[model samples]
Target chain A: MSSTNNQDFLPRSQKWLQISGWLLPFLYVLIVAALYGAFLYAPRERVMGEVQRIFYFHLGSAWNCFLAFFAVALAGVLYLVTRNEFWDHVAAASAEIGIVFATIVLATGSIWARPIWNTWWPWGDPRVTTMLVLWLIYVAYLILRSSLPDGEKKFKLCAVFGIIGFLDVPIVWMSIRWWRTIHPVVIASSGGGLAPKMVHALMIAVPAFTVLYLTALLLRTAMHLHQGVARELNQAVLERGRP
Target chain B: MRSLKLIWILAEKDLRLEYRSRQAFLTTFFFALLILVVFQFAFDPGSTALREAAPGVLWTALLFPGVIQLNRSFQLEKEEGTLHGILLSPVERSLLFSGKFLANWVFLVAIDLLIVVAFVIFFNFSFEAKLAWILLLILLASAGFSAVGTLFAAMVSGIRTREVLLPILLFPIIVPTILAAVNGTQEVLLRHQPQFLVRWIQLLSAFDIIFLAVAFIVFDYVLDE
Candidate 1:
């Protein structure tokens, strides 16, 4: 109904193939098993009790958020060099997913921190501060994209910001890491500093979350593709005046 | 030699324009002064607590008004359409960015000195050797701030609400530099031992180098059509 979504003008018979049907179902099963592994199979913490369970989702979300934003930055480079619409769509789609995952990371992180640290937020934690800044950067990225009308200008501007924002992560980390915050480092070079069961839970949880993020990105990209078709159709009709 | 001279020429052009109009110079200077004055009313200037907190107050006063100068720096070029002219010239995009960055750094340094003087008098600080260290932190932090700020300013200059957008986009990116500047200033001003001063200075210098390099390389995308 909206001007942005006038896709009915296109013939409806062009059914697009979606998902590797059996593979889709398989992923859902794996995700369910991951949930069980996290909640049921994973051993309880002697120290923090049930509150520590939030770490599984929190850690997974954190990993996926990093991956998604890295894609945003890579999309930026690809779009700049190739000037391809596909890369731009990928960048936009990943940013939407990245923000959602970042929110999950922050929300679950605070929940875990409350019972463990007796605080809702630890402002000194470098990881939390860095993630918050990443959120702002992507929010600004989305705003900058929408502010400009459809043209090379928007693509160029958004791409520039996407790259800049990603590159900033290390510097933010370096400065904030100097603070002796109480945010514990779980996963390190030797592996996660946790029990075997907890490590098992994390290994399953991270893979499943990766699947979720990738699926969400694929769906979002498909929606953008449809929108692009409709936009092109709209322009053509305006040019012809009587199509 | 050629690149350095080009940077000088471009920086001189901005300085000359500011000299004639005096818009940014006057506004940025007074704006910083007003921030310090407003802050003075909030705290009893003679108290030890206020003196302990002086470094943060001084840097905030300097940085908030500095954003205005950054925004104005590019707005003038965009308004006059000289930005496009500069983009089309034979010079490399990174070199052009360096020039703009140099001019912005100059503007920030000039205004910062004024703030330091005003800050010292209003806060009742001694004119000590430590002032030199504080000034060095200012120089290093200003380089990092303006390097990124100049790049973001150009990106936002073409937008309709750039006055607001510039700060939103620029502030988060420069957090490290601001942290370093404040901490380093704190060591110089508030502490007797000043143990962390060297480390904070190192952080600021490292921040400047990394961002300056990134901004220089990424600037081509900002200007490229």
Candidate 2:
């Protein structure tokens, strides 16, 4: 029974590992190309200069951050409907990755803002405030995840939270936008009309970061499955030794 | 008809129990009063800055102490093992959520009224007809606050750090409600125009409806054994 259970876990994890292995070199090449596109190819803007380059990675991370959160909500709904542990794993892993990307988005935005907007944090910008709230909500999701022991109960609760958090994002954005209108708008809107090379850099950078997120998600989910297998095997060994 | 009655029964049971003990009621009220007093000290009493911040101060007092009541809502059920008994009942789980949400909403509104009165006296705002709008804002905001709070309180009830975890989980999702509530109060009390009051009320109503529906739908999963 123990050996069969171990084998049951192996094929799925092995399949994910194999896929990630194939993607690894491709991911590497994409990252190199993306770096080249962002740093050397994209022209320095007339105003922000070298600091403007951070927008490539920042925008990429921001896009994937929202994408990863959407995946979390989708996985949550799938888990609730299907009652599959795999979807729960997907939700957990996606939430973790989403948080990492959100942090990157906030940090990069702040770093860029300091030089360009002349402030480290601009509370008046709806996107900035909304992103901060988004970060807090997901961090709370993680905290809720950690405080509970591993079980179906934990998964169900986390899924509920994940879904609710995702639903609140748009409402948060709207309310913050309205609230900002009442106050003085602090940060001027970043000038639009990107240069074509800049657009090309952004296009590459977005896909590269997306691929990175996928790789991280698959590896993390596989790790969780392996950890479960390890725990089960350890329990089996202890039971056998009892004789 | 039966479901509504069942929800009221559940809510009434909680309210009756609190009316008997009155521990949570008194402590939560005093805690809110303390927050109001602390703000008074933090900002100069009756100064223009304090007047400007009065709406924020009022909502802060109203919101933070409400957490104590929410935490205790489930803590009592858990302590007596009544939660399991309630779960084993024939009641629909969503109805169970409504009952809890109603109890919380009613409780918060009651406590907040006294706090608002205290706010009026401390801040020296004359009780006027416009104050009635503040009452309406409290009612709408509490509906949203209680809807989300009861759901989260249930989610975290089984955890050890539920007291801390509940607020962290709750505050972010309710930012819109807070903004609407504070600004709505500002319009009624501080500003003369009251131009944006209708807009804020609309936002609050939307928040209450959306969250109440979402909480009602997702609640079945929250209590499943």
Candidate 3:
């Protein structure tokens, strides 16, 4: 429903979507293959056995969560400077996908942690708690948008929240470091946790998950842009009817 | 000089109003106190290990009261339609922000001091070493929190669900300051080495400056329309 007025920008956004859609399947297949190689083929850990296989995917997802929030911070600065809707869309889209990835990270980390650390939840670990907090914050972002009526106010409010949320990253990192310092490190030895084959399997799995993450983000943004177009047109029609 | 004068006058007006009604402070303090009591029950107080949890408990107490006080700070302006009147004034709108943030910071800090003392008594935590350093960090962190808080409260003041929305928006960002303050205070209570507390204090100062400058700039934009 977009007009030709912004054809240049609109088409690129559509193209990104198309390309992302094409990439998702290829990326998923690559990840599945990598997981297969890592789990079944890779030499099992002497200590963790089958469960060490989850580490590669879990680490990859955690890496993606950090990247997502990093993008969000950049989006915040750009939105502050330009006041453009495009960057806001990018931020909102990234945050949504980031939350999804973070959820996977949390779940998979727990699964991995249980077999190795012998605990489902590890308290005072900075990374885990920070990601959870970040997940909650962005989830609150969605809730916030729903609570506000549609208008400029919603945009500005979300933008401010986006910028402010950047402060949490460093805090989370530091809190973890401090927490680690306070707790006595009783388990220093992994006891020959990873074999060469297992490490090789993880290398393949890492990038696969990252590519899948980027693909999902691009696809989500494309659909969001389409919806924005539909909304503006509806508002235009409603305004035209009033006069 | 005149603008400074205006800032003070507005701040004094706010303080006087709060002094007369006292509801804002009363409710905010009560809210904080109630949360503190709740946290005591939420955890096992009989255990000696509970003392280390003091910082976390202090932060939770401060967080809710901070939001409640922020929401009420602008309620008077909204009720009297004085916000619009103030907007019409030639006073640099940022001054209005300065006034509001100052008053909020002052009131919150007062409430914080009481809570910290209560926290010490309840937890039996020692605050013997580096008392001044800890107080400075707390005040700086309070300034950082209330500065952004004042800006957001104004931004959402026009919205229907501002009451809930402010905390939703404020808490995520405020976590860092809470981290610094709580960590720094923990160091003091534990009598950590001076060098360690210095680093946390430095972080608090950096946070204060960055957020204050941000709110100062962005506040003008928010107030304009």
Which candidate number would show the highest lDDT if scored against the true structure?
Answer: 2
Task: Give the docking tier of candidate 1.
Answer: medium
Model 3 TM-score, all chains together = 0.86
User: Lowest-lDDT window of 10 residues in candidate 2 chain A?
Assistant: A1-10
For candidate 3, what is the lDDT?
0.76
Give, for candidate 3 chain B, the lowest lDDT window spanning 10 residues.
B125-134
Whole-model Cα lDDT of every candidate shown, in order: 0.81, 0.91, 0.76
- lDDT (tens digit, per residue) of candidate 1 on A3-71: 333244223313321553334776798789788988899998887788778888888899999999999
Instruction: Compare the candidates by TM-score and give the number of the best one.
Output: 2
Stretches > 4 Å off in candidate 3: A1-10, A186-200, A241-243, B1-6, B38-52, B92-94, B117-134, B190-195, B221-224
Ranking by lDDT: 2, 1, 3
Between candidates 2 and 3, the DockQ winner: 2
RMSD of 3: 3.5
Residues B1-225, model 2: lDDT tens digits: 999999999999999999999898899999999999999999876689999999999999999899999999999999999988888999989998999999999999999999999999999999889899999999999999999999999998888999899999999999999999999898898885567888889999999999999999999998755
Error of 3 at B38 (Å): 4.1
Candidate 1 has a TM-score of: 0.90
What docking tier does model 3 reach?
Answer: acceptable
